[model samples]
Target: MSFAPYNDLRRHCAALGFGNQWTEAACALGNERFAACPHGDYPRWKAALDGLPAVPPAFRMREGMPCLGEDFQDQQGLADELMTFHPWRKGPLQLAGVTIDTEWRSDWKWSRIAPHIDLSAQRVLDIGCGNGYFGWRMLDAGAELVIGVDPTWVFVMQWLACRHFAGDLANFVLPQGIEDLPEQEVAFDSVFSMGVLYHRRDPAHHLARLHSLLKPGGTLVLETLVLPDDQADGVLVPEGRYARMRNVWAVPGCERLLRWVAEAGFSNAQIVDVNQTTVEEQRSTPWMTFESLDKTLDPQDSARTIEGHPAPRRAVLIARSA
Candidate 1:
């Protein structure tokens, strides 16, 4: 499905003189047909539209106009930058060294338990390892071998980073989902999955697939959004983004997730930690332009709230395989 906002962005760019060139470039990049923009006149072309009223000034135009720059280049740049300086970017994973305060690490309190897990010898698998930041951590933590799986073309960054840091790209595999992970028939001793379960339409199926990938006594680390006590079957935060079967399958409670893990043959499970406070403290960065912020924060927009609250909170879960 096309992200509506991005489609709107394409239209906005077209209105500002970035027409067929931008659209065709974006399509080609989206289809993975080209690496960097073949026509390299992106910055000059984008500069030509610098004063256009239709384009959002906040839009960073550089090297390969709306296409590679916006569509792929920026993301790749961010991934490359993140990989280069990751906390575990160098030596053995130091639990206390990770300082980036992204939403993923907000509730992360693994430092206290780091000493208990034998990361150095365990076979660790990181599912949905976007940019492989955490995967790098696993390696530093002493994991003998760290395998990261991500389906996006963004994996190119992970592949490059692995070649540089780990000395091999074989450790980082690309699989659309757990179901497609058979290429690595070697069962893992521990699996780390974060910020992924909630996005699945069939979370239970995903869990089952994960279970199948593990050897006996494997550990599965999970983190996801959960509904409040009063709300069962998940809550509808904003109109189009509800917790439904075809869409995201938000667990109503730890009990719901535990049930799925148990059905997948996991014998033990529990909420190792809950960060409702962290979620409450979170806030989106304000847009530089008032118009952009207004469109997102407008009171009339049903798509901006959770039962009327500004944003919904998420819950994290950690479970073990039977």
Candidate 2:
């Protein structure tokens, strides 16, 4: 079956100077990837998405956070339906009278970086956009269009479920990655790569890819895990899992990350925020019942991961394309 959201994305991109040919090809690529998704929960997640209650255009943040709640007669049913897509890691999505308290308080990250970038009338791209939580916030910040890409099947389903209620929204999330886009396309005015850099085995290559996505002098907001100041000029390549995530490859200090951004060909690669992640920012919520930051850290010393590496400290950098 054809993905309705992809159709919407194609139409939206057509009007945004991406041209009909690029839209067609990009959406076709997304469709082929979706068709081949091997996730076991894809069927159930798609069913849940199809069953979401129809609502009007009620996309707004509640008390400075992204929310999609609307008055629904069957509130319990709504809760049950949304729970099928468990492990909601990146949001505190308030959906149809039921609040999904996700693992990460993603709004906190948005607050730290939002003031630095001007999303107003900008075409934005978010790589590793878990469930498109940040994309909604980007639209709220007045972005002309927000296109988020992640290869995870369940996250794509989660985004589709959220988009079903958003109603003709300009923000879209594709089941693709930064590598999937053509090199030096330079289509977006702002590009965000949050919590994704460390996962790449070659982070410099990833930064270069992000640089290629932005237009000349366009802004790039990057947030990723970093080591402490004492480890400046040092990069920790975890022997195994770091903070319970196996994909985490490298965690460099703030200075080293700034250097990496500079080497990637971005100018004004300066650090805007550096804060160690806390349990309050990431914890087990009803929406995410699995192991969280608390479990992954050394109980005796919060300063270290269970694997004894420096605990997760993230840094947000704002750079401009050269």
Candidate 3:
């Protein structure tokens, strides 16, 4: 565990809310806590903080929602909020036998899928990478180079951490989307996308773009919210004077999606994981309160359904480019 002198120290101090006056007092306390703790991850560090009744003023109150802060009300806003969380920093800090540093809520999803990845010698890409969490993990997992592309400034936070700790932002790129990627045809050996497909208005088009970026025989790791049955067509959130027009395209089924991936030039498409847990399963964090959000699928029904109800289940897929 080699630590960078001032740069890494400054970023960590800022993140922990020590600010510019991170003197011996703060450093001593932080170093003591860091040395005493067995797990060096975010959740564990947070748990340690929980035990300490006194916290720095910066972290004393909940700044905003976890990933999606108060500043984020829309998709773009959500992206910006994610940046503030600084997920990459969590990678250096591990906890509870798993790393919880990625932008996604479910760390288990990554654990289940990571084994199948041949990242040691591959060039990887993570699309819609919120704060480049998974991308950072991929780098840690031994990918020669990992590129995370997102439109949000939150990625800048991750970039800052990468530069400060890792000394370069080589593996991450903050492009608006695939269209904006520099001229590098079929460059990546593997591409990973989690929790992004369903948000797109045109899933097929997005798949095509992903296919275009991959080399022949490249692998694409995709995870998204899947509907229970095929009856649920995509939901359209109409544009308002203030609200951005967006569409929530739910996953119909694995077969249909695999076919689309094949059409996009990917073969060997397979679903790797399915999590049916409801929103209630989500832990109460400062970022967002899942319990407060109405989990009822029926518009008229007020009662919250815990089990055996219509809820978005996440599905992970691994596909190989033809």
Q: What's the lDDT for residue 155 in model 2?
A: 84
Tens-place lDDT per residue, model 2, 1-322, is: 6654577787788787765455576677787777777788888888888888986647878865566746678878998898898878988787766777889999898889988888889888899998999999989989988888898878888888787766778878888877786442446789899999999999999998888878889999999998899997889999989988999999998888989999999998889899999999999988899988999999999999999999999999999997
- Candidate 2: misplaced stretches above 4 Å? none
lDDT, residue 87, candidate 3: 32
Provide the lDDT at 220 for model 2: 90
Ranking by TM-score: 2, 3, 1
Model 3 C-alpha lDDT per residue in residues 1-70, reported as the tens digit of each score: 4222234343543453433331223334334433443433444434332332221111011111122111
- Cα lDDT tens digits, model 1, 89-150, are 11121111212333233213344235446676666777877645555555556665555666
Error of 2 at 4 (Å): 4.4
True lDDT of residue 95, candidate 2: 74
Off-target runs (Cα >4 Å) in candidate 3 are 1-104, 229-246, 277-284, 287-309
Pairwise lDDT winner, candidates 2 and 3:
2
Q: What is the lDDT of residue 130 in candidate 1?
A: 62
Judged by whole-model lDDT over C-alpha atoms, candidate 1 comes out at 0.46
